[model samples]
Target: MAKTIAVEYRVHDGPDALAHAAAEHFLEQAQKSVAAKGKARIAVSGGSTPKRTFELLANPKEKFLQAMPWEKLELYFVDERTVPPTDKDSNYRMTREAMLDKVPLKPEQVFRIKGELPPEEAAARYESTLRNQFKLEGAEVPRFDVLALGMGDDGHTASIFPHTAGIHELARLVYANQVPQKDTWRVTLTWPVIIQAGEVFFLIGGKDKADPLHRVLQGQYDPETLPSQLIQPKNGKLLFLLDKDAAALLPAPDASGKGKLEIQR
Candidate 1:
């Protein structure tokens, strides 16, 4: 396999519908995995698509959002915006308002980024948290059941922007990215850790995202160019759930590749 794949279109002609569907799919898979193993773990994305998906996921009473076994689930942020939780830009607040506060997942299972601390300290703190849960050393990756990702117009995923030291970080489960123009820093999982996840699903939608999505799917799987390209399951799978616009430029695969769902442009 070339190491990336896509899911059904379920086109709603809008971002909300695709986001809701993707969120529901995530919940469904987690429920089943947890039911069979008594626990489920997730690493989630930070962006508009997942933010919308989180809002829909928060309303468990709704159709697709309903019947989720939250008690058996654990949540993790894929990236943090390097601000305190209450700050308007914090990813934790967005997730809290969207899903965490509404779910019955115990407090300990809901890991939040300590952005209020110094970037290095916050990253170290997050590394300790992950080590305890994954039972892994700082240099090893965690095998989470599912990891949701989002794409940037700049072709970056998580806080891993273009050509930075953050991309080369080998330890400290989290790290500080000192990119200019944007926020001075962000906390994100290293590629080695993220790719080790059992299932890596990227939620890509919107017309603005089409170009980057094409680059990620059809272009080189080069981390220097697109950090997202490096996210691949060591022994599990990778799923790219995209809308029509995002899939427009990708080449299609045949019906025989059972493990991959290639969407014909």
Candidate 2:
């Protein structure tokens, strides 16, 4: 049964402010997770918004670079384009150029989906990797300390395009979805795996996203037409870091730039 999920959002003045907010949130979550356990397992998505956040985290001039516990963090991808790591569209490549090469994190600490392989093969390999890393004995799912996501203008999230087979995938931790709209295959963590994460948040910006974002949060619970709606974390809360353009259609934030809503998942 679907339960009520508390939707919290913080509206930033612009893209730069939004990116800074996201980077700070990332650092805070990582610190909390590491304090709770010995290490933090975080999965991140790829997009322009996240790219800026990654740059901020990796910049030596930024506080995150000096404060982040690099050795105690294990990074993973939430999704990847079905292209080689060297490709322009490869999420791993973007991360490497923006953050990985500059950060103190070792190569082994980053687990990238091998997008160069066949889509199904890549998905299977990633699933096996997760099982081994998390030491899963059976049907248990790996729980990430934090999962960062991005919503597409079309209302898709983590490569789970609207009405795609990825939306119906419940048995697997990873899936190779064929996105007909984009005419490409994508390797992604399934929605079940995503919702199991300890913290789940979306970073969204641009005026183009305003309409779909409105529909995704305020419209009916229709996963087929708006796959972003599928991201209702089991913890009963979700967060959105938005720029003013993206949050235009949503409720106005308080003086502190915070807004809240509740919806049945």
- Residues 1-265, candidate 1, lDDT per residue (tens digit)? 3433454333334676678778778878888788778888988877678878887777756764456777777889888977889998898888887777776767888988798999888888888888888788635767778888888888888898988787888765778777664848888888777877767777888787888877766675677878776665565456777676776665543353112444222
Model 2 lDDT per residue over 37-78, tens place: 989999999999999999999998999999999999999999
True-vs-predicted CA distance for residue 150, candidate 2, Å: 0.2
* Highest lDDT scorer: 2
The whole-model lDDT of each prediction reads: 0.74, 0.96
Lowest summed-lDDT stretch of 10 residues in model 1?
256-265
TM-score of each: 0.87, 0.99
